[model samples]
Target: MYQQNGEEIFVIDGHVHLWDATEENIDHRGGEEFIQCFYDYHTTFTPEDRQWDLDEYRKYGPDRMVDDLFATAAADMAIFQPTYLTDFYTEGFNTTEQNAELAAEYPERFVLNGTFDPRDGDEGLEYLDELHDKYDIPGVKLYTAEWRGDSKGWRLDDEEAFEFLEKCLELGIENIHAHKGPTIRPLNRDAFDVGDIDDAASSFPELNFIVEHVGLPRLDDFCWIGTQESNVYGGLAVAAPFAQNRPGKFSEILSELLWWLGEDRVLFGSDYAIWNPDWLVEEVLEAELTQEHRAEYGVEWDVETKKKVMGENIADLYDIDIEAKRETFRNDDISQEFGLEDHYASGDPAPADD
Candidate 1:
């Protein structure tokens, strides 16, 4: 799980979340939007300690999970989203307030990515403007896996959504995190197949949408989408299946992805808070976990490609200025900039002298 033991290499964790009732922005709200309606929230495969209930979730007390996420030094930067919109929060809730609060509390540890729900119409755009204009959120996350494709016979690239896409383009922001193409049977829903990427990328050349995960079962087609469009991109954030399915073939597929999307285009995401850090990072590091992959997957893990997938790609894509931004955050010095040191365990939180 520790990628490096000494060096303070900057890391950018692409996906993570923060929710505390005590916090200013994450407080209760009433709205008729997807994010808002899930107020009575609880994770599936419920924890053994107690049942899952959004109403009762806070009653257990604000968990230390988000703090753990912030305290961990391995993740130098994290862009997280709420687990979902529930009754506790509103659909119109923009990350601006959350990031502003986080930036004030633990600025260096947190980053912002705006949410877009087409169902809310102009209210969504107004919230997005507040996030971008006031909070400086660099990218947007569209949850097609959950919020979208609800109407009868609606395609992923519907006209209304495309208009929202134009609003994003006008805003000069398109680092979109789209949960595309999960297997239908897996979620047991009318799944949006892999071909959806092709349609979106073809129609919108101005947007920069990074299809999170490899789109499972439709990896080849998704890769093709990354191949054919300059605006299209892909990340191996949830690439564990690819590794377990054909561990030997990881290099081949990853290398092919490198060839198609170029190294900088492929991103890295932990999707943590929901998933374990050790497990997620290891999953991400799976494909290139061995020496044999230099030829098969190109370069090695912890080298340039890892940098690209994990941090560099997104930084460049989003034009993020970490150092400049860090000055304004609350805990720029609580942990080592980056390294394997037990920043939390030690009193000084310093790397070892020897």
Candidate 2:
């Protein structure tokens, strides 16, 4: 329900999660660590809801979670980069055949991203090459915090993750998204305070790394970091549930990031499976985007800037060519299964709801 200069506008959240780890699908492997990511992420999402035991996931609706993400991202369509955790995987957060299946099954809409953890060692590098050369993923995702006791959260300065970024730069994949874990403790509270990986960025000048979540007190620092590093960016997501209960608390971060980093380096994200899209979208729609500096970014207004933060910029970064992809998707059979024709097939939170 957003429009700009009479041009209807919506969002394409760059980040989202979808995992139905029930019994029926535990063996399904529709998503790998992506499954663990959801259950571990939501304290209340439940052992039953989080269990990757196939039979149970189907009961909750396996198709619902992922379908809802696509339905919400772009009303017409969406593009996604799957998230992962490395602890369970023997070889690291390897992109499973399930991920490839999703990407292949919905080529125009899904973009697969693989995770590289230092724990995997040199084998991780070899796996990365497969993602780069064989699979053609646009970026690498890593979480720099102790989530679910994952020691893989080692800082990029630790040399392993840093070396991984250097290789990412060499491979021509400039974008990297890091989840500094939760702002809450026991998981990765301090990791969020650990600001910009300057040493790594300085080493790999060509790489662009985006850190999601302001992570408590480091909000302002994160803004400055994004401003300083041409490759550094910040995104907003799962912070939704928090905002929903207390509204303006998050608006402070939204306004500050916009004030400090400007919208160019700011991106949109919905931590699906953890929080609903409706949670943030409602707040985002209500949050002020207008300002005298609107012209500074070359857009006619702030709404257009939002569009860039949400989808356009990401599409451009991956060289996704959404328009072209849209055209291709239109004639293909897959679009019918995933888009407008069946948009309401799965239940998605209404955009206006909290």
Candidate 3:
């Protein structure tokens, strides 16, 4: 939590991963390329002082992740979005099993989200059942462009995909976080297109389709779809960090999102490890639209809007009572151990090294 102008803001990092891309785990050239791609994004947007070396970037481990997000970063709670690239990594890049370990130890600070590939057929459906039985996941992350043997990609509107989505509804999983952003090598660029989301979202009104990266490089299409569909949401993982290097573009994208989807539907995500939440949270709070841009778009980037984007919107989606959660944190042993009590009570920033 962060205190600003005497108001406490609860933050939920809606996208994070506990991934392993060490040289030993690299199964093929694709694995190396994937990590390199992420490194490019990290170096491009991250400040020099906050950047990590290649060794640390490959496998930062759960200890560093926990400290960066919960103890040091301003995130009150985070949701783990698993990405399992079994073809790229020997033991799957980041599986639900791995994230579940961290969530089990610190239940209050994390929400474990699982994943499934429709291409897996019957075996995949059974796996989903087993995963729900073990983790009781509220959501699942789908990477459409993930390579699988001879196949290049699959669409959300496919018959197999619908079957998996129906099973998710039956098992009480409502949120579907789909990666519809930029494309990497070994996958067709069109596979990352956001067009398929329109069909799936319209077909499944009961489920929430949160488009990860908000269909970047195709923002216009996403904004149009978001305007037409009520269940479609925008996840700001890849898009949020642009505020630092490309403020004008970021402002335009944010304004357009608010103009189309309204304030309640936009969710904050640091896409942690690529970029930490501490600075991203601060940047969002401090970011402002120029007078000309505000007049042109007819959008207001105010304090209340900042609060909703930072955490309130996602907290509402997850059925979390913000004040109650804040009270719980106030009395938590971890808070006292980390001196969060003094930091919050005095309205001073959390110590950088603490």
Can you give the TM-score per candidate against the true fold?
A: 0.68, 0.73, 0.95
Q: Which structure is stronger by lDDT: 2 or 3?
A: 3
Give the distance in Å from residue 48's predicted Cα in candidate 3 to where it truly belongs: 1.2
State the lDDT of candidate 2 residue by residue for 44-110, as single tens digits: 4223333334333323332664455544433333334454432333322323333665566666656
Off by over 4 Å in 2: 1-5, 20-62, 71-83, 86-97, 146-152, 183-189, 215-217, 240-245, 278-283, 289-301, 325-335, 338-354
lDDT of 1 by residue, 1-354 (tens): 135444233467776655443233343432232222223222321233433344433322213544444445445667765334433344223334554565545555566677666666788778777777876666777666443234222334777677677777788777767776442222444455556667777777777778876665567777778778787777665553345445656666676677667877877665553343433444455445446656545655555556567666777777666444433333245444333235433332223212
What tens digits encode model 3's per-residue C-alpha lDDT throughout 1-354?
Answer: 766776667789999988999999998899999999999999999878889988899999988888788775378889999999899999888899989999898887788999989999999999999999999999999999898888888899999999999999999999999988876643335865899899999999999999999998778888899999999999988888878878887888899999999988999998888999868777777677877789998998886777788888778667777666665776565576566765444453322211
- Each model's number of backbone clashes? 12, 14, 0
State the C-alpha lDDT per candidate.
0.55, 0.55, 0.85
Q: After superposition, how far is residue 83 of candidate 3 from its true place, in Å?
A: 0.4
Candidate 2 to truth, TM = 0.73
Look at candidate 3 and give me any clashing residue pairs: none
TM-score of 3: 0.95
